[model samples]
Target: MDRTFTEHLLQWYDANRRDLPWRSNPEPYGVWISEIMAQQTQMERVVAYWRRWMERYPDLGSLAAASEEEVLKVWEGLGYYSRAKNIRKAAELILTDHAGVFPDEIKQIQALPGIGAYTAGAIASIAFNKVAPAVDANVLRVFARLLDIAEPVKAAKVKQEVEQAVLPLIPEKRPGDFNQALMEFGAMICSKRPDCDQCPMSQHCAAFANGTTGERPVLPRKRKAIHIEMATGVLVYNDKVLIQKRKPDDVWPGLWEFPGGCVEKGETPREALVREYMEEVELEIYPAEKITVVSYSYTKYRVTMHCYLCHSANNGQLKPVFNEAVTGQFVSPESLSSYAFPAGHRRLIECMLDEAWFDNLK
Candidate 1:
């Protein structure tokens, strides 16, 4: 472990640290929220969401007691709905078993839902002032570059090696600040395309000396995108549009929105819509011209939605084709203001409705 490197990085962080909302007082609840929001998410976007989340559920108690639907709504556009669910579960556990007090011990914190080694270490150190090593992407990158390690960071063995290497360097006096300073340095100076000249550790960094700063922490290969096609019907009758409630176990579970399905290989968008509508909603649809398309992005995949206007030929007899949709209903376009749609669907509906498509139907 390089003692000088640690001191230099910490000094640089103290002088150049960004004034982020979560770092205000290092509250356990606030730190926990920020860490969760940052998992597989960027810092810039997490800032706004973190501020809004704190405003709504400032403490663990408020979040623990809130309904899942409400929590999902708050985390609507964020994607990875399971993170929000696990957060609630952790809060509930803290409220029930721990009496709403966050556990200070690393093992006890790690036992909570959604919390792993890094998260537990972070909470235990930064918030509870305990001696723990929090190794995340930034820490991994910093250490990998410092040691000139070429192993892919995703490999369990490589990650373990990196943790072992950096664990000895954590200052006994303030492990929390040490961890944050390293992470901040990796974020600002020793970035993916590192600026060696600006990095405080460049003087002794192994990767810098070897001229392989960008190549030390090799990342794993990315998976190919999964293509899914859904034929959908923007089923309309009179002034009302059709919607169905998703099953509690399904993705975007319990949310309400339009009818559609994956477009099969060689199937047209309208045909897929007809098949999906019949299979999922148990109704026949005559899809009109394309109305709108909504593109939603996530860490591993992206969905491009193509919606079309249609009239229900079956009139009143409608049953959900798949068990995931428990029930179906029709709401007037003007009256849809009261119903809650999935965030993506809401955006698509707004786009279609704003163009006066519903008005022309009358």
Candidate 2:
């Protein structure tokens, strides 16, 4: 790679970089939080979450002391709840293992939960001025185009080559600025549909010269989304809805949802709901009329949920048998506002509200 590319990119970045909140005062804690939130999330959407999160737990000590419920509550709408959990765990480790100080060394930072190579490199270079490369998808795209490499960008071998290519370009005195500049450049000028006409690195980009900017960064083939059909029972007894708390290790840990599971083959939605309630809470339910259906997309699968209004088969005599991993409770319709629920369950709650079912309860 030409040395002029780094100089020109830095100049462009100094003039054109977005005035992000994390950029205002780049501290290790704040940058770490921002990086974690920014993963698989857009920058525009993350700004407000980052601001509110910083306000709630301003330092490592506060985050370390917070309960999982409190942490998940603050991170309610932020998908990938595990990131929030990992951040809290990392905070606690920093406090106890590292004596409440954000470690400046890349290895030490990487030792924390959820701190992978990309995140560790970002924190090290951006916050600590270490000569490290932060090779995220943006950087990968940039590097692939700059050198006009055709290897799959997501491949491990390609990533290793990109990291090596970027290492030599890191300026000794301003490694952080250079690293951030590369990321910012890729984000703004060298995107998937790059603006080559306005790009400062257009003259230096081999893909642009070769007229292959759009095709150089080869991505892995996408897997088809698996379609899943599910049924959930919204059991309302004596004006209280029965909800189950997910196991800590489950997908949406600690979140409340109507008791049910995926619909099995060769079974009706109603039958699935009855069986699910029995399996999940050990309570027999008489599945009633279909209340609503909701569709949601997860990372690997698309789910269509069939929700039904249900009643206890024993005429309210059956109480939920709480196991060690999962628990259940009956909550008033109005009180449901206080609990956090998955997106699909939240939609179910909205449907019940829209139909005024809770208002008609005797």
Candidate 3:
């Protein structure tokens, strides 16, 4: 345990931590939510979502009582759907086993659905006032530069080494502040393109001293961007709407969405939709209004959705659009309440329902 490092970092934190709401109380639930929101998302964006979420679901008891669809709706556009799922599961576990109180012990906290070692350490240190090591990406970056370690810090196995190195350095009286200081230091000073001139640790930072500020702790390369061109049909007959269910084997399994297909390299969105319709549903559609365009990102790929309001030229027959979707039906606006639509579909639906005054307002 390097007492000097811990003290030095915490001293800097006293003047420089960000003004975030979650930092006010060190509540376990608040910290947990912040940590989850911070994953694969920008801190600025997470701040808004976090504030709204805490207001919506104040505690585990309230979260466990909410429906799955409602929870997912609240978590829409955040991506990484599993984080919301695990959070709900953890809420249920807390209600059933822990009697609604969040567990304070490191092992118990780690045993929760979404809580890992870093999360466990965070909750314990920040909420319970324990001296647990909180090691995350920021901490790893900071420590890697400080120790001049050049290995790829993201190698899953290196987590233990990072945790061990910080374990002994945690301050005894204010471990939570110490952990936050290290994270803040990494975020503000020892960043990817760090400003060593303004850093408190620049004098002691091994990487800065050796002029290897940008070289140590090499991160793994990012995956190639997945390209997709999808065609979505906004079918309207009378005042009703048309939507289909995505089968369990489908990419967006169990979600309700407009009928569409991915476009090939040479084909346009409209052409792809027509081709997919013939192949999947054995139905022909005459395009009417090209309504709007939307986009969303999944784990491995991104989607560009071209929505077209279409009508059957001859009121033609409709059938399953591919083996992945077995049902294609028209629905009253009221029926929307019974279905769980994908986030993008729901947004599109809202726009469709608001079409009358949308132009006037625009």
Candidate 4:
């Protein structure tokens, strides 16, 4: 690696850095929150959420004192609900273990619930100005193209090699700026379809010199998405819908959704909904008209959900099976705003509103 590339990259960053909200006030707690929210999410989308979050919980003490429900409510549509839970857990740990102060050390930051090596490095370098490397997808892409690395970027060995390569370039005086410059360069110039012509480091980029800029950062082949079909019951009584809280071990934990489960191999959607409601809530529900079919994709599976309007048999009260961790309740449609729901269920709410199911209640 040549030093001139670093010099040009830094100069370009100084002249063209985006005016992000986190950059305006780079406190440790705010930086930590922004980094977590920015993962797998675009920066433009994260800005509003980050600002609202900062206003709601100004510091570690406020976040530490917040309940999981409150935290998830703010993080409702962010997807990846586990990150919200982990942030709360990390905040509590910081309060109890570190006296409500964000840890400055890289290892201590990584010790938090969801703070991985990348997040820790980001906070350490950006907020604390420590000589650390934050090698996320963007950084990996930038380095792979710059060095013409042909290995799969997702592989552990490739990642380790990139980290080793990055460590030597961290200037002691401006480590944070250098790290952010590399990240910004990747994001703006050297993306999946890079703007190689506009890149300040084009002369130094090995892949560009070899005319293989697009082919350098090779990734492993992705597995096919597993298809899943589900049936869900939208139980309404006196204008209130029965929603179940997902189990902590379940996907999208801490978020509420319509009561239902996967459709069995031979069962119809309505039959599956009836059976699921009986087993999970111990309530017999009569499935009525089909409300809507919703589809969503997770990282590994694609799901199609069949939701139906259901009423309790004989208007019987639900005897929900509740453990210490998971529970169910009936809440008015208006009250849904207070709880965080999965995107599919959120869309279901819109459908209900469109059908005027809650208009009379309002």
Reference-based lDDT, each prediction: 0.80, 0.88, 0.79, 0.88
Angstrom error at residue 244, model 4? 1.4
Better of 1 and 3 by TM-score: 1
lDDT of 3 by residue, 1-362 (tens): 35776677777889889998899987999999998888878889899999889999998888999886677767776766668878999999998999889998999999999889888998899888899999989989987888787788888667778888888888778888888888778778787888788888777788888888788777889898897778888666665667777775666555667777888888888888887767665667766777788787777678888888776654544444454485768787767766767767777777766775123210
Across 1-362, the per-residue lDDT of candidate 4 in tens digits comes to 86777788799999999998888778899899999999989988899999999999988888889999999999988898889989999999999999888999999999999999999999999999999999999999998998899888899999999999999888888888898998898888888888888777888889999998878799888898899999887887877888888888888888898888899998999999998888887788888888899998878999999989898885545566644228788898888888889998988888978887667541
Candidate 3 residue 106 Cα shift, in angstroms, is 1.7
Off by over 4 Å in 2: 322-325, 351-357
TM-scores, all candidates, are 0.91, 0.93, 0.86, 0.95
Error of 1 at 357 (Å): 4.3
Output the lDDT of residue 308, model 2. Answer: 88
TM-score, candidate 1, is 0.91
For all candidates, the clash counts are 9, 0, 4, 0
Give the per-residue lDDT digits (tens) of candidate 2, residues 66-108.
8987888788777888899899999999998999999999999
Better of 2 and 4 by TM-score: 4
Best by TM-score: 4
Q: Which stretches of candidate 1 lie over 4 Å from their true place?
A: 316-322, 332-346, 353-362
Candidate with better lDDT, 2 vs 3: 2
lDDT digits (tens) for residues 218-249 of candidate 1: 88888887655444567777666788878878
What would the TM-score be for candidate 3 when compared with the true structure?
A: 0.86
